[model samples]
Target: MPNSDNPSFQTEKASERLQRHADEISVRLTERGAVPNFPEPDDRTLRSFSLGEVAEILGVSGSYLRQLSIDGLGTTPETGTAGRRSYTLRQINELRAYLARTRRKEALKFCPRRREGEKLQIISVGGSASTTTSLYLAQGLALQGYRVLAIDLDPDGSLSKMFGYDYPGICFPDRYVSMYGALRYDDDRSSMSSVIRRTHFHGLDLVPGNCELEIFERESTKRFHSEDLRIADASIKMVSALKEVEANYDVVVIRCGGGIFLTAGAYGAATGVLRTVRPEWPEIMSMRISLSFLSHFVSLMEEAGMSVNHHFTKYLVTRHNPRDFSQQEAVAFLRKSLGHGLLTATVWESDAIRDAEVKKRSLYELVAGAVGRSAYEQAMETLNSTNAEVMDIIYEVWGRPPMYVMRASRIAGKASS
Candidate 1:
């Protein structure tokens, strides 16, 4: 069963009605004194569905069930001969719920008016400082033509500098228009429009960061101590800011800091979290620690009576060196361990990326002139391929086309209007 706090669990009609549907069928069969030809598995036996049985239950063919598993939509059944494969009742229920929602979506598509305020996905990218992986992914998405707003919440200002902001710290006065401004609680929420600044890269905007942003921790702590703020208030502030400008961008990527206070806030507001981990021993160890922290944070949020809408956490392998035996071994381990949770994208090691960082330019803007032609091309290919995979994951989760495609749809909608 899905967690009660999960938004999808709360609103998915098919999921909510599963038990009732079963009960109604059971009652009708009992009245008729019918001996059911097929076995009706108990709901408690969620992990006991054979492939053929579940297929019959969901009204989908066995081949379709296999395809869904292959496409990473549902759990992979234990493999056996063509007639012997088996699935879990939980997997079948989930698939049925998914199909129901998809059918509902298709029906809604032909309706007269689209729903107002379609969700603007806010993806929180969290990782250690060792790999500036979040920044690369953000730039890649922007270059791929998505309307992307990248908020730099790290007090180190690395993301700020990468976009050509030379300042080490945001000045005091500018705090009102920075991330601090957006998360600052007041009677009238500050407009994120004024705080967002255009970056040099096309389709990418920045919510500039600086060391001064660290003051958010102090302010949040003060509010919490005074009993005027809840544990979830920081996240509320973040979500509210994004909602205010929801129509302006297709996606919002927040770069979280090292501190739990900031990262927890970002997690609370995120639809999903992208975790970048390098395939090295030390980095893998850190990744474990980070995962544990995230788990604890979610538990605390639930305990504090906050409704968590977060659906998934994905892992991206960064700084991978194919030739290194240890890295190859670790990558293999991760693939087996994480299974579908691991992204198809892998950021291969490249010196050109380091060069771009030193020059304070986005990797998307790097050219053959700055680095050797061959090296630049190779780097671009690796980065673009990795980002493209990430984009596929985004599309799957958001169930929407890219911003450019959405623009045409919007225009056609208006012309009809």
Candidate 2:
């Protein structure tokens, strides 16, 4: 009001202000020991699993695995002090392959990998705890012998950080390509395979996202305003990009963000959708809004002659406190409303999980006693239960028997005999 034309009265442009803030943050992070463009290939490593853990994961007896090691079959595990044995994830997978070949009748139970006729499973995970759910699901599947690819579609790169790839600190714009590179509308668009980065978890890979992914939203908005037919096509970008690398993976888990274009693309390409929710009123209401939006989106795709069908759409309850009466009632309400769509297992909110996250690691990456024994076991129990439920759904979709059910039946038969 004093002087409209004065340079001091002029406001800074939003883009410039944002750039300044980012630069300041970069300097602060650098000062705090975060190296810019840091190459951290060996920073995160998976811990070896003990013999009992390996046997449980393989659905076999510990003595059976011990005999195999004594007989020098498959990959020999590392023997520790007191003659205890531990197996690396790579070794576990080798054992899986060996068992699948030797035991033809239980081959699927041993390997559980996608075969010739089994279509690649593309799961789009979203809503509350989506990043954590995707991380655990991808790692859990890998531990169980499935080749998994996890794609981070969030511009914030939260899922990427969980995999030890902090794009903001480690990624070089000129050297690394993100998922946006593969989904861009321009001629410089690259293949999805080119952006795949291996994580420390065996048999699992990651396609990270960075700030550049935000550019896609702007570009898509412009195209939509121009009435571009390509923008309206649901099966254009993400579906085609994933098809390039479909043969290499047994399953692909995408961590969806809020961008409309990328979210729609994820929905269009998904074989299944996992919606995570907390046992709370606010989260339930938010999920309702999300479901409404999804319904409308599916209808629009159908009108456009694109069949938007998923093998399954399931809800997973996370961060649940069982002792809380209100949370219990919320879960009960969800179960009544969702019926079979809601998974049987709920992920309990645990201090152990929160502690691991603070250390920028997942529970699978930690040793048993790394975070108090009782807490770790409880956290793993819930996580494993939830993951196994999802795996049961996958098995059903592939027309295979549930591995747990089959194992239980085999145990009962052995007892009867």
Candidate 3:
């Protein structure tokens, strides 16, 4: 061991040294061009959807959409090679709005935005794959014409990266504010609307997360130990914050982090809770512990006179490998154990999803065949099917028929006529 009197042995505190290392790493990454400099938020644009994709998403026939374009009804789509047409997300929304206005009978189908008496839906997604699940679910809802707000509660800022906020790389504390600014218990707390940032996804906004969120956890814990009952009330700070921008969105999807304080706030604000789990045995066991903790948290909230009720609570199995016997066995076991609480559709593990993430994009943001055709198709099928099932649940909670069922009824009526 070095002598204490030796000047060379003098060192900064561990925390200070670690922070310096992080700053050095970030600087090195920028210098090496390993990460792109932060682009303008408007510079990140979603790819246009082909005519078939728009038709499917809008639950309308291709012929009807083509005729509408010919008649100058909605925004004209961009004509591509060989006269193929594609619609930007903004154009798609314009078409949805036009159809909802002109065709009142199918307005709900055309524009699924919430109506009077419908409370804003807030879904909290937690567990190992929370970031991935939240990313797809929020973008999927936006694609289907629902106004969505995605709040990133993770200190790691993984979900923020997916939305083009690259945390330390692009989103620095001095510039962009995280959800912590809105949820902080001090007089400096800002309105939630002020912290909200627009994303490339037309109908989806983001409250990006950064290192500052970790401060909320530390402060809240200190308050709790000091016998501050206000901390209990602050557990619903997210709910209070969301109310300020409630009218702007139909749903809010929150990616829960590991911090108990923030996770509790997310749980308190949620109208629904989706717990994601991998199909491996170890992960399943870990999920059981998480569920037990959730139960205890709910009890505590209830004891404090806070209503802990949710519209729905569901488990989603992610990163599923159908070819693996062990994973198949795990899925079967989960289905048996969780019963109706488990979603029927599982998100398959696909190379396409991994590839997209490497580029800091979601599968939804990629054009068809951007990845290998077969891989992309399989990945999209898994995502669409999984999100569809969740949407059906949301519809059921609202006492409305499933979208597929409504579409089928309309088609049946046309055939009978």
- List the RMSD of every prediction in angstroms: 24.7, 5.6, 5.9
Which numbered prediction scores highest in lDDT against the true structure? 2
lDDT of 3: 0.84
Candidate 2 per-residue lDDT, tens place, 10-112, comes to: 6867577667777777777777977544355437678999998898889899999999999999889999999999999999999999999999998998899
Model 3 weakest 10-residue run by lDDT: 167-176
| Candidate 3 TM-score versus the reference | 0.86
- Model 1: lDDT equals 0.66
lDDT of 3 at 129: 78
Q: For candidate 3, lDDT tens digit of each residue in 116-232?
A: 888899999999878999999999999989999999998888998888776573344323378888888778787788778889999999998887788888888888888564434
RMSD from true fold, candidate 2: 5.6
Which candidate tops TM-score?
A: 2
Candidate 1 per-residue C-alpha lDDT over 1-417 given as tens digits, one digit per residue, 9 for 90 to 100: 657886766667875577566667667775697633222222211134566555643434678877877787756667677646665433444555566566665432211111344466677887753226667777655434456788888787677767655345434332253577777665544578867877655557888776656777887788778966777777777878888887777677888887566788889889878888889888889889888988887777777887888656788887788999999999999999999888765777878777877876645554466767666766665565555555655665656443322432333354346
Residue 164 of model 3 has an lDDT of: 75
- Quantify all predictions' global Cα lDDT against the true fold: 0.66, 0.85, 0.84
User: What's the TM-score of each model vs. the native?
Assistant: 0.65, 0.87, 0.86
